[model samples]
Target: MVDSVKVAGIQMEPKILEKELNLERCLDFIQTAARQGAKLLVFPECALTGYCFSSLDEGLSVAEAIPGPSTEAIASVCRELEVYVVMGLLEKSGNKCYNALAFVGPEGLIGSYRKIHLPYLGIDRFATPGNRPFRVYDTPVGRVGLNICFDVRFPESSRVMALQGAEVIALPTNWPKGAESAPRFIVHTRAYENRVNYIAVDRVGVERGFRFIGQSKIVDYNGRTLAEADVSREEIIYADLDLKATREKRVVIIPGEFELPLFEGRRPEFYGLICERGESVEC
Candidate 1:
């Protein structure tokens, strides 16, 4: 595995329900990020269809097929530049619609992650629920995880990814403006607790009634904010991540059945008593 990889986070507002214009901007940004020596690039959530749009009709009308035009365009870039890309899209799955994150590598369409933990605001009304909470994909840079806008708030999302061997958790977000501080703090906490790198990409401009906060950030395992962009500006945040740095700092065993199966031997029966109290609340 490579010791270090250069990555970039794209921060720009998307057009309201305009797929053509949004895709044009996506291609342009991909090229720009590629020129900046970015081995991996990430975009904000609901990039295909502007976030906060009124109806499922809008998401459905703009929804694309995986490996469809959106993925195809990015695939060409990945193939041509040999760089990996993670982008957000609206997916029209049978009988349901999903807010999905796609991972494209040089080999073509790598895998896509559907957004779990939909926000109670408008997304729950406009989008369908995801079956799984977290997804990790293998890439040249290392194991990469995908979590859409609201997934990281739960902690279990990032924890599962890190336990699953994800070196970096790339979040595609479209955070609302005026609330930048809290989200910034949250991403760092996720990274700090998991001992993994966290990259969050968000948009800058306003669409419909929602104005996005544009401070795309990358945080290290020590809860350090490595780089952050301004909340109202359009810019790319770039950084070179040393993959080995995470392993050296990891000292805890956060065990989960899906990703951290190594902890299966650990006193689950002993811990079951503790979980029973919380299980009623969770279920």
Candidate 2:
């Protein structure tokens, strides 16, 4: 894998139920980001199809199969530009529709991640919950993990990826208004705790009466913001990630007294309470 790579987060608004127009805009953004030297580019959740669907039928109407038209078109572009892309879209598999992210490279479709955690808001209320375990895929850039909007709220999602040797965690989110703490603080906390690069790409504009907050950003392994986009504008944020630094989880802050052994010090036996089934608590 390359030691350092330039990555980008495409933050744009998608027209509701306008698949053709959204695909066109997504292609344009991919081309633009490729021209700017971004090896890996990530788009927001439902970047091709807008969120906030009124019912399951509405979501099914726009959902497409994984190796279907959308991925084929994006794979062709990836082949031409020689860049890897991770984009979120509505995926239709058998009789179920899922909130999924597709990873495409210069060769073809690499892999995909179905959103495991489903929230009550937007299309997630109607989409089927993902059944697969959290996974980390090895890529030309580095080992990367995928997750969507509400999935970030659970620390185990990112921790599982980091445990599997993921150097970067890409979160394609649709963070609506009244949830500013996620991008402002949680994103950094996730990266710092895992010692891995984190990229949260969010869209802007109102959809189905609910407004989305767009503060797309990329944070390094040290939990420092490398780049961030405006809250209300369409923009692309880029950052150079160092693979070597991300792989080194241990941090020696004070030589001998305050060294942080991020991975080696894990006490997994006491964390079984997180897996025990119980009533959900509302914070």
Candidate 3:
């Protein structure tokens, strides 16, 4: 019901294998952002537990159930601050481990999204692929969707959420040194293509010798950079996002002449190949 929401992206480093320390850091950041009138706060991928684990056992060590102690702690803080947060952490389900983002609010645990696309680097190399379908959670802030680090690379993920009426997509990512192009191009491209406000929060500092690029960014529905962080510092970037404006997919520059009905002009019938998989389905 809110027309606009102030979003904050916390760009901080998580210590490897230090769950308690990371949780403390997250609480500190949450308090700081909430006090600043930020309605929605997003943290980097594995912000509760650092990425680049050597093995699945190691990841599972810090990994917890979605609504377990860590999320409960966050929910308590959210209740006091009256805010919403999307934070990344490793998830342990039975014998499998997954890289996930938990969406918590003042009420309680809203939902969680597991990383569907598993890149061959860091903990993702060993984590189980996400099993659930993409979902958009309607909250006090807006219709918010969740995605992890590698999931941003796939256009289908964002498109799916956009089709589900998601106004904002919170992407908690851990971008290393070689993945500079993601923040530079992909974040804004996804925002423009989907007409949804996109916030990508990335971590800083080195974990296991892999230096993460901390260029956390917040882009509007029009793909404009509202706020951005530096490459190697711990910082918080803020943006006042217009949720109502994101829902207006039809853009009229000259009223009758230069009108762009982005969603209305979609040709899903011809885009069947996007849903097809396997090597048999040729490009």
Candidate 4:
């Protein structure tokens, strides 16, 4: 297993309802990133199909099944380049449509993550909530986990993945203008609290008049920002992550004088309210 790996995040604008064009753009980015020595390349949410869909039917029109045409094409590229690619798309399974991210490696389609926490925005407003549990995909690059746009707001999402031994968590997001705080603070907070490397890839450009904020970034396990992109542009950010360092959750500052045993110090028994579903009551 490689302890050190270079990762890249592609922040680009996707034309709404243009699957083929978006796929071509994704392919171009994939080739460029791979050539630049990135083993893991992550794209923004709904890179294949644009967000801000007017209806569920519209989302369904472009949604495809996992291991479908897109993943197969991406897998072929990965096979040729020996790289891993994670891109967001609308997924159709049975009678439900989900906002999802597909993890494709050189081997083939590794797995996919449905957006569990769906905010009332874009395709998620009409899409079905994710039914599966949060999963961490163990790859040659590292133990990688995935989260969609709004999932980052819920700390439990990242906590679960971190507990499952996720060395790197990729967050494919489509943040609009009002969501400036997310890129400024949330990414670092999640990485610091979980003691895992985090990458939040967001889109750029206006979609149906809703402009996306393109502050895609890569943060280290200790909450340090390795690379960050501007707020409005198409760009690729790279960061060399130390997978082995992320495994050492115990941060010994001055030989235990000020140490933080992240997971080991968790007191889960007292955090029961987090899992309890109940009527909203002012505490």
* Higher-scoring candidate on TM-score, 2 or 3: 3
Q: Mark the regions of model 4 whose C-alpha exceeds 4 Å error after superposition.
A: 279-283
Which residue runs does candidate 2 get wrong by more than 4 Å?
A: 280-283
Error of 3 at 62 (Å): 0.8
As a whole number from 0 to 100, the lDDT of residue 270 in candidate 2 is: 81
What lDDT is obtained when candidate 2 is compared to the true structure? 0.93
Model 4 C-alpha lDDT per residue in residues 164-223, reported as the tens digit of each score: 999999999999999999999999999999989998999999999898989999999988
Q: Local error of candidate 1 at 19, Å?
A: 0.9
- Sort all candidates by lDDT, best to worst: 3, 4, 2, 1
The local lDDT score (0 to 100) that residue 160 gets in candidate 1 is: 76
- TM per candidate comes to 0.88, 0.97, 0.98, 0.98
- lDDT by candidate, in order shown: 0.80, 0.93, 0.94, 0.93
Q: Sort the candidates on TM-score, descending order.
A: 3, 4, 2, 1
Q: Candidate 4's C-alpha lDDT? A: 0.93
Per-residue alpha-carbon lDDT of model 1 for 34-70, expressed as tens digits?
9999998999887777777577876688887787888
Error of 2 at 172 (Å): 0.3
Give candidate 1's error at residue 232 in angstroms. Answer: 0.8
Instruction: Tell me the deviation in Å of residue 142 in model 2.
Output: 0.8
lDDT of 3: 0.94
Would you list the clashing residue pairs of candidate 1?
A: none
**lDDT score, candidate 1, position 167:** 81
Task: Please provide, for model 2 over 58-148, each residue's C-alpha lDDT reduced to its tens digit, 9 standing for 90 to 100.
Answer: 9989999986799889999999999999989999987799999999998889999899999999899999999889999898989999999
Off by over 4 Å in 3: 279-283
Candidate with maximal TM-score = 3
